[model samples]
Target: MAEEEQCNQFKKYQDYFEKQSDLMKKYDETLFDRWLHGEKGVIDQPPQHQGERRCIDFNCCHSEMDSTYSMYCQTSRVPYCHQHYSYTRYLQPPILCTSNPGINITTKFVHTSINKNKTPVYCMRWTPDGRRIVTGNEKGEFTFWNGLQFNFACLSGAHDTAVRCMTWSHSGGHMVSGEQGSNGSSSIIYWNPSLAPVVTLKTAHSELIREVSFSPNDLRFASCSDDKTIGIWDFNKQVCEIRFDESENAVYSVDWHPTESLLLSSSKGKVRIWDPRLKEKVGMFSPHKTEINKVRWNKNGKWFLTCSKDFKIILHDIRMFNKPLMIFEKHMKDVTIVNWHPIQEDFFVSGGANGVIYFWDTEHSKPIGEIPVAHDGAIWDLQWHPVGHLLASCAHDQTTKFWSRDRCGDSLEIKKYQGTNRDYDPIIPMYDDDLEQPYLAPVFIPNQINPSRINGFHDI
Candidate 1:
């Protein structure tokens, strides 16, 4: 019965596949169909060209296989059959976080969970209780890892294609995930704590889904996609309450304000702010010179960060939308992901395409500490642990890593103003004449009111 259902799902999209471009048709002929047909394990394919490197799998005679079907272990740099390569890659030592305490916080290497199928982890988040880390992967599956031991717990298939994005409600009562539209259909699946799908919204987007974010109240969530639309959904109704189609280009990322009704979506170089109450865009600004890959709101929602292909990360204050609060541009490659410290709002970390992870303090423009090498490939996602002592990152290298506090007994904590709940010093101090000036207030001169402003409105 299950096989029949799977075939029906495949057949439903058959016409869409048939209408694809010639390049896509070639992919369908070579690999796509076989993968969806439940073909698993190391595949043997005809070599496209002769190469010196051969599979290093024990006693395996398959040599010079097509590079598309075989890959070398990122750490070992030795070729292996797909199966053995995944095994070896996951066994490689964790990359440690090396840093000099600027704000007195740093991270060290922790254990990693192995994906036996070599399914690259695309998105991950710690359960609200911080007991387990759930990862959505390229295989449309979810793998749960024990938070303490950092070992695999279980796996569940959730989609028919890549699980592109996912988010957990603030209370952990609900979990939602979105998928790539490889079969001309994308879906959003709401799950229970046990990893069982409770509600499935098929064809949620016309193109690949980029992100799904839950509001702070958890009453509603938002999803954005390459279809150039954002959907506001009410999970109780399992329907899209509103669809935003103002973006002129493909939307790559979306995030809900941690404590507000505002929704943020990034398309090309611009970020637009939408208020669900208004059902229209309230503000839009171009923060980067190129495509912005990700945008995240701080827990307080008063500040947010955006990283882009321009190799820069900008911090913006919600009140001051016209200008950035700080611009951090130390990354040598395109910065892929930025995660704020769960407890220390003044500090955050970023991972780059060159595999370098940087620790930054908003008070300074430079990175305080860094992991010169965090992965063998570009980092796809990053999430700080709930309490802020640990960090988790996944990358194109086909592995997920954990990092924890590096030192045991140091006073590795930042101090903020007394009698205040804020996590940062609200005022910037200036250094002048060997003395720190807490305030350098700008002088202002009053100007006469415009005579044209009669009682209220101005007319052309």
Candidate 2:
């Protein structure tokens, strides 16, 4: 009888795995590791098996060889044994996750301050004056910085959750931040160094808010959220003046035209235009073919840029309102954000989920250069240095990198000047300053294969 009972129990275990065998073939161990560590949420009740079923981890102290164990991965929803559960405790970095095949940079980023205290940075913006920067983090904290120093006035619990969006007014002295709601409630928190909750608009949206923008005049602000509605708020009253309900899909980004009364929003693969003065839809643009991630009004506010999850960047002339002036498709992953160079009208930069930052010449619709591994993970936000060609980028890697123009290399030399002339010299012999040397020539790397070096000539 005892032998028969043991055989039946073993048979049931075999049956359970047999039923899941097909899906098991598609299971990825790396993905399983992410899910087990709570890196990804695959199911609602992912803690582990409950009740008399006991822990699925065979390493459990109370576990016996004959004990029953079962648990499901929330992401894969696949039943896994408990012993496999404790495997994460003795974590080994996967060999596959470490190798990064990327462009060997002739130009590289200079990693600056690493904010270890805050949760990963989500959004960032620079004051119009460019003297100060404000960053919002996943921990719902607001960190203000000047130069490389952290300000003493960092605001804690500014949002109670990740601050997904931040806007610094063009003329006003205040900043507005939007947070992802833990519940169905979302709010906007306005702050200045001196005041806490200078003004708080609670329950500003019915769901998590994705972005917020203060108008050019700072008299009004606009917000978009997962609730599929856009809210226009009156700054003085601290109340929503009106809401646009045209989009059935959640709005991801919104930007107020720099000099006009118009506002632009990206949602449901559509570009929406709203006339805040009249509180009505003025016009709409449909250049994007997928959900848009970000929209930005150029310096003059005449042209705008929009990037989408479809990996396309479209430049729209606000006056035309119907067609994209340029369509850029250099990104390999869904794009996160786009920013215009403060001084160079034709120059713009974009970052994507793959951690590549591309510098583009909008007039040509092609990438002029790139930072191959700007971040190890997706970049969340990018801000151009207010005065120079330096760019500030924040990413999922928990670091903010400041990239500067490589004045002596790559972009300026390789493509701009070199072209196809391997023999092109910076200084002509007639214009040579040094009479003894005539002109400077590139030094051939010692013992290295130099395609540009003449092997027959040897070394004079």
Highest-scoring model, TM-score: 1
Stretches of candidate 1 exceeding 4 Å from the true structure: 1-104, 409-460
Give a tens-digit lDDT track for model 1, residues 239-329.
8999999558989889999888999888889999999999999999999979899998988778999999999999999899769999998
Q: Which ten residues in a row have the lowest lDDT in candidate 1?
A: 451-460
Q: What is the alpha-carbon lDDT for the whole of candidate 1?
A: 0.68
Worst 10 residues of 2 by lDDT: 96-105
lDDT for model 2 comes to 0.63
lDDT per residue, candidate 2, 1-460, as tens digits? 9758656654553454356544352443333455457653332232222113211121221232113222211121111111222322321111111111011111234335566583688888766665556677888876665533322334456778888887767764888888898778888988774435688888998788988888878999999999999999998899899999865788988888888888888896888889988989888767777889998898788899999999999888887868779998879999998987765666678899998888766665556456667787899998865553346788888766665432211332333321111221231122233232222132322223323222111000
| Prediction RMSDs, each to the true structure | 21.9, 19.9
Which residue pairs collide in model 1, if any? none
Give each model a TM-score: 0.67, 0.65
Strongest candidate by lDDT = 1
**Candidate 1 vs. true structure, TM-score:** 0.67
Clashes of each: 0, 8
